[model samples]
Target: MEIDPDLQGSVESSHDPIPTVVAGPSGIRPSLYAASNTSASTSTTSFGIRDPWRVTPDFAPSVGSSSGRSVHRSDTWYPAVPSESRKFEILYIPDPSRAMMKKEAALNLGWTNRDITPAHFESIKHLTGLVYKTGRTKDRVKVLVTEWLWILLQMDLFENSEAFDVRFMQWQDFRAIILDPTNDIEGWNMLAKVDCIIGGIDYSVDHSGEGNSYHLNMDELARYESCVAQLASQTLFWPPIRLARQASMKWNTICHLQMIARLHGSYTPRTVRLSTGQDIPDDVVLKRSHSECAKHVILPTASRSRRTWEYLNAHTDKYEFWMAQEYVQSLDQIGEWRVFIVGGNVISVVHTYKTSDDGWKGTVTESFLTLDEIREIVEKEPTPIRPADLRRKIVNPESGAAPIRSRARDDFMGFVLTTWKHLVARETRDTGAKPSICLFCRVDVGIRIDMSGQAPPAYFVNEVERSPNTSIWLRFHDNTMGTLADTFAMVFKRWLMDIRNPYIL
Candidate 1:
């Protein structure tokens, strides 16, 4: 983990702006890669060139240098972490009965022999043990955990695939099941069973149960059900094709649906390299011209328009239109924090940084570096450098790659946890007596620049997922023994605590 400062410097300076090739008057241009080589050959004197998409070295100030004050806007807020600590018993062992139940559930879903692989069974067993620790009955645990598997399977089947028509059909059927639970289609599939499990969970807390047993009140349960329904109805059912169609015909509806998807946790934003060295057209630039500039100028109508247009057109001709999803465009950073909250308390936090090549839409890996360390790492070797390539350089030898602890880091964690608390509170207030808006879920918050005052940057929630992948568990226990066992134990423990001691206003 001892990175040579020289190596870091070399990497930091290596990111030269990618040379772009604009189409000439003939409407043809050399390939971007070829133009890049030509540009490099022409500009040997320019050193320390950086990609516009890559975060600058000074983009993130050192955490220690921050004022340590929580900056709140009228639209933004953060929740304070609880001072008290409670220890709960953890169960790591998998049960045979639960394993059998999972197999049965899988079979009931029409999973063929080929579909129910050993890996899927292992996943079921692991997850079942986790949910069992929440003090649910064998049957209840099986249903809940099985539903998780079903959701994951469906996401894998449809979301990542190009078969839009099939996804749309399946989603329509799934939406029906969610909206009307009593529909008794003869061949009720796994998703149908998932709907039933979600709809039927007894949210009433069983006060008579022994320690570690937990249950949500009816209202709390309803809230969770609503989230599941929305996820299925909005996210799953609304195919990309439908979204595109709505964009033109029903812009507002599309925006609302996109918001729901973001709230329910869609994929993390990744940066997109639209086209390297492509010039913006004059008409496109003029379309974006400010009226104030035209008003201030005193030249004759024709000359003023011509000069102003030419001046504005000069920069447009050399620009690259690197773009991201709307949600990403709203944020200021390429990294986001995934904070795991249970019972309104932050249990764990991980920083995820996106690679540069994909814009804001690429895969991210957990980074254990502190804000300062992260700055150094990015300065040295900008991401979307592959994780495998950056691992050895970013990991700290002393902490064995555990997340670095610092005052700035703590403040950030507090800010995210607090923001989530406020968001849940607002949801509850708006909904009025619904099930808890979020009993146990992951909240993804993007770090955004704040210029409202002299305050430093702040975090803004980008998405909330009721059933986020528990992959953080794997990353947290990477160097530990029985990582899978630990993952199940911790997940169940938090879930149980969340139910038993539900967050209150």
Candidate 2:
């Protein structure tokens, strides 16, 4: 199922957070969009920048000249192609009566703290230090380009609504975030006075290759990042860019699931490597370690997997390395489920089917998740013994098989909830927060039921998303968006004020 329509879209482009761990061999930072926008020329300069941000208007930047200049700041950043001014969209204006301003009451929502974020930032510090240690010319250039792209992309997290798509990520509406710890009526009269504009950067550029290639190789980009962390501390307060990178990036999400599964003995696919074109003992599927979307994942078999790998390598926006996961084998049972969770409640559970139209690299189109499914995906869990009638064809979800659900839907929900709690607990043992603070997220799970009914059904979490994409299959657009909007409101509230107490949401 196409659980997340734009999941891989941000990753493929460099606008989203991408840790160095999955940067592949080149370690050359990513800064390009997907097929539709890859070659879009970022060849203009209308930034109207000031000081450190140079004001270069209407020309391609001359590359080699800015290298050795001992200037106070780095030179201006040119665009991949000339594009329009980056525009900001107001996603929501809060109703103050509905917002929680009290320090304790507002904090009741779970927000993540002291976990993947620290590790990721530390990785940035480590890699930049390691790269600059050589002090050679090329090393300096790459580090300069990498760090610049990283900062622009980080800021783009809020600016580009099409890329981020989540309403609350911008952090303008979080009232409780500014609460005084000891005040019982802290922030009783405080409501965010500004519109939550979903645009961070002054302008947008082709974040793809064209974008990364234009920056001057100077110390300015590196300095810019540190500048934001300290001066823009309020924006980075609790978790804004940190959450996007930690949860939105597929590789990071997989890492989170693996850790949770290991500590609790829960199920996740046995992740294996397939970029080398090694032999596949059984059926295996290719998944982007940092991207999302079922369309991007049209399952490739052992032999064809190599072909898909090659295709991604040729694309400037696509990653060179990805996970070749173990496919779930269904002797008789078949189908997939996308369980949507918001504000710590099960909003809807969807059942998906396979589609006939297929895309390049054998990535077949599947039925998208519809917003109409009622209650749990499955009405009941599978019986201990498999029903004889169900022992039919050997269907593979990797192939074009339609999804199935019954009683297992609730179990899947429970699985996600319990796992999230454990994840919060382990990550926040000393951070002082409860584990029930996750405001919005989605879990894509696969299930297997025995044909002979001898063994119990097995369900594995294929993916997790904090800023999940709401598919076009919605039946209630207005109510869904309204509820969905509130789902993440509290998170941004804490982030806006930089509140970190009474636990994880």
Candidate 3:
């Protein structure tokens, strides 16, 4: 069956079954097809939990479908199965043994013993195992995995180093060494040597093993060097302030230019302007109230907050308020839902919340807490408490039991799925057929309490993370039920399979 050119970008389609066969490295194959109009049904169980997985019958047809109808915009969008012939299967591997082996290998490779901690090795192993299990050629896997490890190591060094100027200088030196081909074996530190080795490995992958002795032409080398230098310089000069108006613009421009030179793409959290119906670059912080913005303002020179409206008035252009009508705010609580989507389906949901008094604006926290403990605090505390102040034992979400099913939760999940589909349609319309945006991504939804308290809380799209951090899954390995690693493996395997298909690519 051929997809209608006009309808290709839309997520909705007619009742026709589009045969899709998914095959993965593990050899498990599954066949999926779009559901017929009559087959779609929505029914609620006695527990009041709506089955979001059930197909809804009111889905609109794609532009070129037999009905020739377009989907209608509503307060909440609904999911529709696409007729496109895309399928994928997932394959996952356990990591404890793999991490141990890699730790030994790093030691033999002259890595400092102190730098190779168990936690660090495990992190490396998880990423490497992900690449290996997804069926990358052995040589390619080694090179890519090692490069990732090296990047992580560099990040750790920059973060842990006491002297920022010293670390910046080292980064400059490292960038110079990487760009120079003939400067071999003079006086370099262990980190510099490791950087050189990583570069060599990357080149070897590109040349299919001939890169061991390969040297780039002067022009190509100059361009590569320039790109690295720009990235390093930008990082060195990034503003310490969270959301300074001019500083953010400068940093974003540099980042975009660097990505262009590196042949990569970058994304920022989406910021929609309600008045102009346009997307502008801005950051939104949801707390107790919109007026709370006064409490969070940073002075031009220091980290302390300044109370004078004169300060803001002095810099009107640099401090304009860009509002999103969809911004979710509540009187007692502020939180967001993290919905993980794999192969166009919502696989997992995590609710992160903080009380109004906590002072922290977002869902993310440096400290950890279990769902039960968090629930207890919410139930008992008359005022919000910071997560860091909690003294209870930490429990990873992976080991915790499934969240108690509820209609409200189901509705939130449905809203997230719908938002993703809408965003995907917009992306496709803007940038033709790009497979990268359709794969695994995370959607963050901010929750706002209904004023009337007659229905569930309203959900608003906060942002979407295309490349979410995967280290959190490692915490779920010890779960008696299905671990997060298992879910990730399945989803990642499927994503890899999708990319491998020439049609999808």
Candidate 4:
């Protein structure tokens, strides 16, 4: 049957099957929950504990806010199926087993069905098309989509990279087998591909406890995984034109990397240009991935419970692109930058830069700023000096070495403005997309979009360690160690050297 263009076709038009995992002897409890916690609101926020019986709409008390009503009320008994108005519906339930499973599954799963309206999915597709332009080639898109699903599965505990590697081939050899035909003979690559398809979201980690939070019960787990895998399986098998498109896109990324390197002098290339513009050649330039730039830097002193690096690294493929760029400048002008504390060690800085030739009128560049001397700036007082008078130095003490402050804060600001000008020029010529304002700085100095158009929920900045009081909170952590003087310098440095990339899915 011809499917509606709007429906992803993951779920068919057949009558909705009676959910197999019903409200046992307790009777049916209305679950207002969503399909996946893929809601953009929760995308950056912590996955806090949720109450299964709580009505989904009632939870929207505001972003960053979750209640303890569900906590202290341990004896509060919810019916098997609560009133639909105040319930969270998970996709499916286990067969009277896994009762110990946290009811968060209900909230996470319910959101997909209840929260993500058809309009939201359409917008996602529209945004995806806009950012990617021509869709990526079939092979590359498949690999990326496969990688993304694998990362998600890894998060949900279907199986991890290590397990998959052992079952299919050596972890190190897996990439080689997929890419090289001469070295691979047994067609293990094809078998590996099949494993990826079947395992999509249903894979599970065997361990238990809070760590077991990674795994969902079988019923709910299978639903989401099947959705993605089934969608992928419906496409025509590896079309020829798709391969060419993937090759072209990869080539484009590489070319952009090289061109940016030349402009910043991060590489040896003298100059390169697309039909639109030319590259800037300078030795002290920096190039970073989008992953590095959008990272939610969190400070350590703010919280004790945290996800360790080992845990995050387990899903590196999902987050390899998260990163940051550092710019060196005078230490005096830090207070002017918008700063936030994410955790004890992480400090988040945001700023924009104008091209070198024009005043602040040129294209603006946005980036995440990092610095070694961040603490000093956060603690010190502000100065009245202008940023244009500071001295500038492109080279630090040594390669792969962090920069130390050598001059007064005013001097650092001068250097920062100069470097920022260069960055603006480069970004304007590269990706034509620019923001009218720097979200971090809250300044109307650059190209920006009406964030209201996207209808972003209200964001609340909390001063204390308690969970956010709102349904969603955009947390920005400042990780730099420096005084107020140092903070200004780091802020200016970020303005000069920060890098920005497209958020194409």
Best by lDDT: 2
How high is each candidate's TM-score? 0.32, 0.44, 0.36, 0.19
Q: Which is the winner by lDDT between candidate 3 and candidate 4? A: 3
The C-alpha stretches of model 4 lying farther than 4 A from their native spots are: 1-227, 233-259, 263-505
What's the lDDT for candidate 2? Answer: 0.33
How many backbone collisions does model 4 have?
99
For each candidate, the alpha-carbon lDDT, in order, equals: 0.31, 0.33, 0.31, 0.23
**Per-residue lDDT of candidate 1, residues 1-505 (tens digit):** 2222221211122222212222232221121001111111111111122322212232211110011122122213434322112322111112112233434534321111223333333434434322222223433332324333333333222322211111111223333443343342321232321111221211111211232122333343333345333333322221111221111121122233344436655333332222333442322212211111112212222244443434444423211122223333213234555665543444455555534563222222333345455444445543344444443443322343333444444545555554454454444343342122233455666643222322333345554454222233322323321322223233332332222222212
lDDT of candidate 1?
Answer: 0.31
Whole-model alpha-carbon lDDT for candidate 4: 0.23
Error (Å) of candidate 1 at residue 325 is 9.7
- TM-score of candidate 2 against the unseen true structure: 0.44
Which regions of candidate 2 fall more than 4 Å away from where they truly are? 1-231, 236-239, 274-282, 295-298, 301-309, 315-320, 329-333, 358-410, 426-437, 452-455, 468-481, 490-505
Give candidate 4's error at residue 87 in angstroms: 30
Best by TM-score: 2
Candidate 3 CA-lDDT value:
0.31
